[model samples]
Target: MTKNETDERRAAMALLAAATARELDSAWTAWPERPAVEDLRKAACGLVMVRGRIGGDGAPFNLGEATVTRAAVRLSTGHIGHAYLLGRAPERARLAAIFDALWQDVSARPRVDTELLAPVRARLAAEAAKAVAEAAATRVEFFTVTRGDNQEAAS
Candidate 1:
């Protein structure tokens, strides 16, 4: 695959993983059957340091630490999958990793994309749009008005 295609696939997998367990469960019902998965590493919770940069371009600094759950699994056919998720939802992490592995399989990619990833992507986009609209509604605009003295000075 080309670089662009690889990047796009990675992005799609990320979107699939962002789905909540409820969403995944709903989508999974539509799937014909679940692929067999073997847990290489059961889900475990750990701390990761969150980092940020001042003004998005300045020196980076540790913002804080966040709790994350991670898991690793292998498909019956030998594909490996891994996931890292914020908070302590081990089941979600496992499910996400399974989806990730399934997504890598060419035969499974279409089904996973259509039944699982697409809906999640749409929902996330809709939520983001709503947030942007709500923030826009409260937006404040500022302007400057020239006083008589300033106008005279310019003249």
Candidate 2:
């Protein structure tokens, strides 16, 4: 493989990885189940999605009709959190709710955005860079020595 080929692969991987990271970050930031209050409506607090189970190592088994709920929250002081429990645990919901409340507090947004989101993004960038570098490192060049037009060998 030539340097150009390696560079192209690196660019493609970086784009894909960066896109995936951005999407995850967006989902975390914009959870769906937010309350609508008269005075203060906050950014999405938690998200609920239907996930299918694949294996049985105590693993989630998608019954084709069952789903689980997951939530994420950022505390007022910028502590991020996540929860995904079995059978829609109300306690987990409450935990997420509590964090949501804390997150909505006017003081929480800046720190969470700056500290947590920023670092996660930075780490993602670093990982993408490392991946590209590693791929590039493995690139190989192939060449063939052809006979010169003047076939006489130099003494």
Candidate of highest TM-score: 1
What is the RMSD of candidate 1? 3.1
Candidate 1 lDDT over 41-127, as tens digits, reads: 999999999999999999999999999899999988788878887889888888888888877788988888888888888999999
The deviation in Å at residue 89 for candidate 2 is: 14
Q: State residue 8's C-alpha deviation in candidate 2, in Å.
A: 28
Candidate 2, poorest ten consecutive residues by summed lDDT: 36-45
Could you tell me the TM-score of candidate 2? 0.33
TM for every model, in the order presented, reads 0.83, 0.33
Task: Output the number of the lDDT-best candidate.
Answer: 1
Clashes of each: 0, 2
Local distance difference test values of all predictions, in order: 0.83, 0.45
List where candidate 1 sits over 4 angstroms from the true fold: 142-155
CA RMSD, predictions in order: 3.1, 15.2
In candidate 1, how many Å is residue 83 off?
0.9
